[model samples]
Target: MPMNDADAHVAAQIRAVLAAAEAGGGVAPIVEAGDPILRQTTRPFDGQVDDAELAQLAEVMRATMLAAPGVGLAGPQVGIGLSMFVAEDPGSLDPETAEVRQRSPMPLRVVLNAEYTPATSENVAFFEGCLSIPGYQAVVARPRSIELTGVDLNGTPIAEVVAGWSARIVAHETDHLDGIMYLDKAEMRSLSTNTSVAKFWNQPSTQQAASELGFTLPSSMLL
Candidate 1:
């Protein structure tokens, strides 16, 4: 597909950011919540960026995510309105936290044009945070499992059934492509600062947080 004017402008901006990062030997600066790019629907990953550029972008994105020490990152978070993201999890939680959150390790994955659907009726509420929205966390009820489909940088197809914390990561990152932030779906009353979360709400499950914060989780999770 040909790049429309708006997409062309975005592509230029993306290439410029990549070039600056390569020249400066620094990671891409993550854009914060108020950026218009983060609120815009992303363009599909056509050939707007060449293979070499795409590879460089991926490398830079990976480096940025690691530097941010975040489990996932999206294009919009870096000021590129493109449907792409990288995700990985070391799964280094303690046994109790791991068991309660169903968190497991995930190898680094770069997904383009991603989309997901709920794989089960069950919903889980957790204190989810985002790189774009730094310093705050909120309780969000999301499907416990999801069917994810997308393509890789090489244009290879990607399809998988993701569950547990990985599923939440997938949903969260994919939502970025559609101009959706986790805050849009979060329980407003359950919002907490990072310090507060560490001090008061750092539990394996969100049940206590929900109770004390005066918010409710999905009824499905109550069963």
Candidate 2:
């Protein structure tokens, strides 16, 4: 299918970004939070680029996410206003921490035009940091499980219920597609610098941080 004018423009921009990234050692510079691109809703994928180009784009996104050492990366974070993201977690946390967060290994996956909704009323709070924000972490309550729907790079449909840390990952990435940031729903009082988070708020759960920082957790999480 031929791209419309808007899609063609976006495709050209994407190609330019990819070319620049390749020229600059294969990793695109992550756009910061203040960029307008990060604030606008992303455009959905439609044959803007061919399958081979899309695959290359996904690979570059994967490499960028890994290099950022972040579990997720959305197109807007790299200055492309596309509804796509890459996510993966090595599940490297210690057993106790992993159990507390319900975190496990998540293989690298690319999701395009993704959206999600709560699959259960249960909510969980944990500190999250974004690469675009770079140096701050805050506690955000999110659905413990979610039904995510989207397509893969090959345009295969994806519909699944994901829980625990995986759910959080999907929720965060999907929000980018709609121009929402985690901080928008976060407990501002629970915000802390990366150093502060490491020195004071490092724990399996947010209970200690919430109590000490004068913030409150969801009723379900309160002991």
Candidate 3:
């Protein structure tokens, strides 16, 4: 599908942001995964949104997701350790080609330091990946619908209901900024699809990281 003017504009902005990050001038700075900041639940910024910084973040997220080959990306995943994520609306798939194509339905929404409340008790499971953990994926259970409240990239407050895959995307990315991984909420070994988890664990450092993180490998993660 042809992109509209607004969509095209956002795409262009995303590209520019990513380019700057690649040049080492866009993102604020990198933080280690186990840093204290990553563990705390992210709080909404009280002051006005800095358009320049927010724009850079959105661009970095977009670029990071594209580079990592994932549908969504959060700020912490890129090492910025902030309450932000840039996600393509999971429901906006383009059915024209063999490869899946999706766009942000709300024109690149930037949920800043958001909080999520499930609107429905109905739960669903989906395959999820992370930009922080490259070359791995898992089947994680998530709420089918949610009521999320947060400020946008421009710092405008929003409290809206979302359903389908969009809710999942938002919830998954939000957790990243809070330093929570999907494995933290996963129910069983089958939810994990990390094919290389065993191999990676065979190495001493990787094994140590897994052990330190308290991640157990699932024998079989899929049906």
Candidate 4:
């Protein structure tokens, strides 16, 4: 049965609390690194998608992302092996209106077995982070634009073009589904708090830029 309205509301409240906590303080303990599952790349669900099971997993994914205050998350990150993921582009917050609008030009896509084809010739560098490996970030080179094809939450196929930070986020989470880490593909990497990341987002490159700033970069970033 679907979650009742009251139950859903309460769950949303709890998720909001967890998200706030994660955004400010950081995530609580989850799966440990080198737990075998993290290293295993997941296979697509070959059988029919069970609506009930899909709903349950989708809820878990959303709650997990909220709890982590992340832009996107994958099933494998939560220790599941199916090809599924959740994404919410936390784009820009309208201060006066208090309305949150998606910053990415692309739609908020729920992707399954999503693949990417770069549209632009050159890639752009963006500082990326992950919930699985908290307090660490790196400058990863991602396509300026991409064409994505995947199944939606309802198992409906979709093909769309995405660009900018939105493209980066989708690709990042999709990599999780494929058992790849952002650090594995980054040009340079560091670990720090959101405060530090925001502070140094656009500063001119300097010796200071070479190392992690603001939030201390942990010697060992992975849990």
Candidate 5:
């Protein structure tokens, strides 16, 4: 889809800020939950955010995500209410041993005005975390596979079928664009502090959360 003109002046201001961040400036502050910005539905990037400006935003966001050491970040998290988000999961690691588990790797990528369709009836649940909602995780369930559609910074289209952790990351970030957070889909009783997660629910699968944590995990997620 094509973009229209938004507040042109707002666009210019953001362009300059993003450019500065791209040039080794400070990372944009992440907005936390209960902030009105995170609750507001983001608008599609109008012509106001030109391709060059969009590219700069992507770079800065990527840098911030890597610096935060998170697998995903969204525009709203950075106080930009635009329909854009970034996600990358190179692999998983053992925090104690620093041993990397070769999970499916997703290189850094940005998607704008993203939309997705569930490609499978099966559901997958995992203990997911977020940058905005730091130091905690919850069991969130979603389609095991999905067809994601969106655009890059250059106004081109992007479409792909993704599965595993990649699908979870895509679903989580796109939810931010829609003013939705992972907590919305998370099993409330399964929520845990980071330390609690490490202690009680840090098993190979969330199937243990039900028995050890005394929470209900959907049967579909048990493999």
Candidate 6:
């Protein structure tokens, strides 16, 4: 049965509180793709960062994301639609050279009421898997650069143009707040099971998938 407004609110509060109280602020279970929450837009967060409940929720989200080992996560993925998400990318890999790129690790960041726009016309494809989706991945074509704007946990304004892998993470988490999933933009033919990806398509770039699996690479991703 679908949740009513009051029931959903109560459930969200309970989840946030329980997630906050778990030892070390344990990871929350990610809501799966078919959940209504994942498909709906989130409400604005009007609560102050200093608010005890809000801070606790943030901590819980951070703990959960790191525990899941995901670079980004959205509130809806955790059964809340509070226009909140967290992201942190520890490193990057150069797809062609198989070289680890040196980039500053983003400490856990909370983006609320986030907005993103393409910073460039170029599109690139890459294999993306969502925590909610579990064991499947797909090649998604996304803008190569993005201008992201949002508020931090403390409600501080953030505005920046980001590119490369960083831009991908930003666009991804922001899309969650907008009721979009990578699958919605993914190449249908490029879908693969996680096991298949590990055995066949799990290279640094999307190029391997194009050649091995007959997936189409966005022009920007072509050599």
Which is the leading candidate under TM-score? Answer: 2
Comparing 2 with 5 on TM-score, the higher-scoring candidate is: 2
Model 6 TM-score relative to the real fold: 0.85
Clashes of each: 0, 0, 0, 0, 0, 0
Estimated TM-score per prediction?
0.95, 0.97, 0.63, 0.69, 0.86, 0.85
**Candidate 3 lDDT, tens digit per residue, 31-71?**
43465655655434533234774576677667556555567
Ranking by TM-score: 2, 1, 5, 6, 4, 3
Better of 1 and 6 by lDDT: 1
lDDT of 2 by residue, 1-223 (tens): 6668877877886897799779868787888888888888888998888888888888888888889889999988887888999999998458988998999999988999999999999999999999889999999999999999999988899999999998999899899888899999999999899999999988898999988889889888999
- Looking at model 5, report the run of 10 residues with the lowest lDDT sum: 94-103
lDDT of 4: 0.62
Ranking by lDDT: 1, 2, 5, 6, 4, 3
- Candidate 1: pairs in clash: none
Residue pairs with clashing backbones, model 5: none
Candidate 4 clashes between residue pairs 3 or more apart in a chain or in different chains: none
Local distance difference test, candidate 2: 0.89
> Which TM-score value belongs to model 5?
0.86
Report lDDT (Cα) of residue 2, candidate 5.
39
Per lDDT, the best of the predicted structures is: 1
Error of 2 at 167 (Å): 0.7
If both were scored by lDDT, which would come out higher, candidate 2 or candidate 3? 2
Instruction: Write candidate 1's Cα lDDT for 1-223 as tens digits.
Output: 6778977987797798797787767688899999988889998887887899888888888889999879999999988988999998998469999998999999999999999999999999999899999999999899999999999988999888999999999999999999999999999999999999999998898888888889988887663
lDDT of 5 by residue, 82-176 (tens): 88898888766654221211147688888988999899987867788989998999988888889999888777898888887788888999999
List the candidate 4 regions with Cα displacement exceeding 4 Å. Answer: 1-32, 94-102, 105-108, 189-223
What number of backbone clashes does candidate 2 have, counting pairs of residues 3 or more apart or in separate chains? 0
Candidate 6 local distance difference test against the native: 0.76
- Residue-level lDDT of model 6, residues 126-147, one tens digit each, is 7788988989989887787889
Give residue 48's error in model 1 in angstroms: 0.7
